[model samples]
Target: MATPRTRGAARAAAALAAGVLAVSLTACGGDDDGGDEDKSGGTGGTGTTVTLPRLDGESLEVAAVWTGTEQANFKKVLAEFEKRTGAKVTFVPAQDPIINFLGSKIAGGAPPDVAMLPQPGAIKQAVERNWAKPLGAGAQAELAKNYSPGWQDIGKVDGKQYGVYYKAANKSLIWYNTQVFENAGAAEPKTWDELLTTARTVYDSGVTPFSVGGADGWTLTDWFENVYLSQAGPEKYDQLAKHEIKWTDPSVKEALTTLAEIWGKKDYVAGGASGALQTEFPASVTQTFTGGDQPKAGMVYEGDFVQVNIGETKAKVGTDAKVFPFPAVGDAPPVVSGGDAAVILRDSEAAQALATFLASPDAARVQAKLGGYLSPNKSVPDSAYPNEVQREMAKALIDAGDDFRFDMSDQAPQAFGGTPGKGEWKALQDFLKNPEDVAGTQAKLEADAAAAYGN
Candidate 1:
């Protein structure tokens, strides 16, 4: 799950790992004068006793699938929120397999007040099963104006809003070692032909051109989606998501062909890199730059969040590691992958207040301070960004407008996120395992989609 960012500039690294780690309260700079009363009704004002209700009187239970470093960041945000609202947040961090745990809980009728889902499909499924509620009128209006149009659309299952996005990173970029490109006398590519030439040049320089990890069964799908964008453009991609078009379309076939061409290049990727199938997504990304000290691979195609995962690596941002938008293949429009919204579940006073605050430009600034994330609020100024890279990325996002889209896998039905699902990841894995059966694989996907839509 790589979040999308604006292109053309490097952003300051905000430690988002802790933000996604778990839900807990972190102390913030605020007075704890319980006896100090404010006289401005429920609102805090001088001489009035303003006491905000805590999130959970005894314990606020929150469930999420963000583990490892990401879970840690999530706890930090919760901790800060609890301090501000005097709530006790109990965090339940789970593995990537969140659906199973959540399914049982929803069935048991003991659902958490707030659940942080990585994919939009999970939220949709929850809504379908009545395990979740829509943000309703107020939340919808406020969030609609705060986030990007694409982010807002992700939370919509049918025509109702059910989620709000808090933290997001963009994925339509390629990360390369700046020094490697400079040493190889190669420039950042702006077109598919240029990219291929650059990759070939790098490969001929006695280094693995790309450090992609296809072993995980999903990493290779990144290439597929980007290729599709290059071939069919963003408009067709959207139709595909809504089941308006079949997966066996010529655009899809061309994308797959392009991927096969890249993968066909021997030594283009690290030897034994396919072993990454056994490794997790984060670990596989780390493997790309892990051996750069010995120059195993020079570049990797991933989202901006990879910067947060590759800790202790000598790859410094803008120096050792830099990102560029995936070059256009033919006449296709640019498409990037970003996270969905983080919907508010509880309509408590605190939840309402928090929601209102988050919808404000001020709150967007606060979020940037907490973790240099792209704010959906259009009102926030680019100068407010802490780092040059972030500022540039934010600018790109604003300019991208309707061209940006959510990750197809995340936008698809929940079943698509699973192993047996009909998604780009599963499709790529099947294609790679049996290249000769590409058409059969595409046919199976089309059949599944048709069945799901009852067409």
Candidate 2:
């Protein structure tokens, strides 16, 4: 799913109207000597420390939207930072439309030192408004050494770096119950035709083939995006993302019609369309993983975030629950990804130090070992991941380089791509309810998109 973020000056003005104030960190610089450390790849030991110059004990406020398992894992990373630099790191959760909170803070002149943003659009807005400080030379060098040029580009606004992409989630994956597939004698699909055939095989074995999460509209968007990228290719994907062509363009219809092939067969989806419409994304994963039911689905398609939901179920990843790249609909599988970007809001030696740490392999290793987090840093080894599948997924995404794209919805404004109850979500929900009405769905998509882009 594309993580949602807000934009526009009107939104900033509205946030300031609400009188929400952001509290800044009070810890000042100290003379403590954090051992002189290098900015290269290392495990930060007595001989090799992860330290930034002149930032030994300054307090820094960091912000992001991570919660639950993600939050817990990040704390481990922060703990490592505290050990390395002796700087106090406080995590402040950015509320919905972080633009609002950021706007209020900027207007009040109390922004955090570093804000970990989730949207490229927000990064662009922050850079344009001069609310973000570009990554320091140390941080940029780390990024240049550890991350691919594509990952680095997401942080750039007009070819100048304003942020560092730390964590990435590959969205082009379909998680399935190994037992269910094995019992049905259905191997993992390699192509769209193979996937349809596998769906039929699973359906024939007295089970629904897919746990469609129609209620959580972003899941639906991911479904459409994976197919769109594979069928229409990445160039058109880029064009569609920028709204250079209308959403009513034939590429969208081709994707939807392909979706209808499986969706029109109501029996293939657990609880049919109505149940799917009521099912949330987490529940969809649970339904697929928790089998031995009357009408349970076999697979749930989503990003690695679903792994957190899977932790709540009885299934184990790699052993019981397995995933494959969404079977290619065209020449090759689509490698869709999404992640958080760390941007400096307060220009300071301490803030720049923190940015340098976040951009390094040392910081990424802390979270990678805990699972559900994939770092774009190439220096982080594959063995650091929790499972081979996840390791391969992250490696494939990194290796995909120029071939990969951020979630399309994330690239668009929230109203057009990321909103829950309106825009693409609602329009796609309508299509799920009636898959055969491709033209009608296309019309709504164009109208909402046009309104969203003001085209």
Best by TM-score: 2
lDDT of 2 by residue, 305-338 (tens): 7777777787767666767767778755776788
Where is model 2 poorest over a 10-residue stretch in terms of lDDT?
20-29
lDDT of each: 0.59, 0.75
In model 1, what lDDT does residue 383 have?
A: 54
Query: lDDT tens digits, residues 1-455, model 1?
Result: 22243221112111121121110122111112223232222222211112334555645566776666656755765665676667777778754445667777767877666676767777877787676666645556666666667667777778777777665656666777666676787777767888889988787676678776665554666667777755766667778877788888877777777776666566666653354344456655565556553466777777756756554365555545666767777553245566634544444555554444445454455444333367656655665554445555655565555445566766666555433324555666667655556678678777766765556
Q: What TM-score does candidate 2 get on C-alpha atoms?
A: 0.83
Candidate 1 stretches greater than 4 Å from native: 1-58, 136-138, 148-150, 344-367, 370-372, 379-384, 417-424, 434-436, 451-454
In order of appearance, the predictions have TM-scores of 0.79, 0.83
Which clashing pairs does model 2 show? Answer: none
